[model samples]
Target: MRLDKFLKISRIIKRRTVAKDFAEGERVMVNGRIAKPSTDVKKGDILTLRIGDRETVFEILDIKDNVKAAEAKNLYRIIE
Candidate 1:
């Protein structure tokens, strides 16, 4: 799945456009490298997103085209 789509489907960023813009702004990273919205997302990949002074990291656990709200979080695992 696409990085942007995964972000939205995972409810990480809430919207695909926002996720794309975040990537364009270099606020999202995959495996510690800047990643574009079109970047392919695969299981076990690490994603880092910067939000001001805060940072969030997640490990890709699964990929799904569509998931229920209750199951969205299962797509990724938060990393400490």
Candidate 2:
């Protein structure tokens, strides 16, 4: 799935547009490399998100076009 979509579906950033902005501004990374909003994300990929002075990491567990709010957390596993 696209990085922005994945982020929204997984409830990481709450909205696709916000995720896109973060990716476009170089605040996100995939597998240790900077990634764009359109970047392809897949299972097992490591994602790093720079939020102010904190860095959050997650491992993609699954990808889906849609998911319920209760199930969103199942899409990725927090690493830190």
Candidate 3:
């Protein structure tokens, strides 16, 4: 799945446009490298999102086109 779509479908960013903007602005990274909105995302890939000064890292566990609110968190595993 596209990185932007994955973020929205996974409910990580809430909206696809916001996710695209984040990716375009270089606020999102995949496997430790800056990624664009069209970047491909797959299982086991590490993703890091910068929100202000804080960084949120996660490992992609699965990819789904649509997910229920209750199941959204299953798409990725948070890294501490």
lDDT per model, in order? 0.95, 0.97, 0.96
Model with the higher TM-score, candidate 1 or 2: 2
Rank by TM-score (best first): 2, 3, 1
Q: TM-score per candidate, in order?
A: 0.97, 0.98, 0.98
lDDT of 2: 0.97
Query: For model 1, what is the error of residue 31's alpha carbon versus the real structure, in angstroms, after optimal superposition?
Result: 0.6
Model 2 misplaced stretches (Cα beyond 4 Å): none
Model 1: weakest 10-residue lDDT segment is 71-80
On residues 1-80, what C-alpha lDDT tens digit does candidate 2 reach at each position? 89999999999999999999999999999999999999999999999999998999999999999799999999999999
List candidate 3 stretches off by more than 4 Å: none
Could you tell me the lDDT of residue 62 within candidate 1?
Answer: 96
Number of the candidate with higher TM-score, 1 or 3: 3
* Better model by lDDT: candidate 1 vs candidate 2: 2
